[model samples]
Target: MITFQVKDMSCGHCVSVITQAVMAADPQAQVQIDLATHRVSIEPAAADAAALREAIAEAGYTPVPV
Candidate 1:
């Protein structure tokens, strides 16, 4: 599992975009987001931590590894 702290994620749309970005990177990945804490946890089926991080970053957000 990999976790990232996305401070800019504030609403449902943010969650949706992040989830989509993660899924796009690894379709079989499992994603969990805590909007209140600004945390995103992912269980990647094939993608690596670096790839996932880039995916989130490409989605227009700052993903700080936590």
Candidate 2:
């Protein structure tokens, strides 16, 4: 699983958006968002961290390596 610290994800809506973005990129990916810590954890088929980070950014959030 790859984890990212998404600074802009502050609420439920943000979680949904990030979840959709990650799923759109990798359909089989398992995404978990923790609003308390502002962290997103994804278990994707492949370790495409760059693409994942970009997808998160495109979802209107800031994804920083964690």
Candidate 3:
């Protein structure tokens, strides 16, 4: 698994959007988000982290100063 810091993530809605974005790039992606700590853990490490990042950006979850 790979862990990403999405410091802006703070609620269930944020989870949903991030999940969708990751899945769009790789349908079988397994995503786990921790709102309390602002961390996102994705499984299947071989997946393209860059694509996932882009998809999240497209979903408007831009990270700032994380």
TM-scores of all predicted structures: 0.99, 0.93, 0.81
Count residue pairs with overlapping backbones in model 3: 0
lDDT of 1 by residue, 1-66 (tens): 899999999999999999999999999999999999999999999999999999999999999999
Q: Ten consecutive residues with minimal summed lDDT in candidate 1?
A: 1-10
State the C-alpha lDDT per candidate.
0.99, 0.89, 0.76
- Which clashing pairs does model 3 show? none
Rank order by TM-score, top first? 1, 2, 3
Q: What is the lDDT of residue 43 in candidate 1?
A: 96
lDDT of 3 at 28: 87
**Tens-digit lDDT track of model 3 for 1-66:** 667788778789999998988888778888888889888777744567677777777888864323
Off by over 4 Å in 1: none
What is the lDDT, from 0 to 100, of the residue 52 in candidate 1? 99
Better of 2 and 3 by TM-score: 2
Give candidate 2 misplaced runs (Cα > 4 Å). none
Q: What TM-score quantifies how close candidate 1 is to the native fold?
A: 0.99
Model 2 lDDT tens row, 1-66: 899998878889899999999988888898988999999999997539899999989988899989
What is the Cα-based TM-score of model 3?
0.81
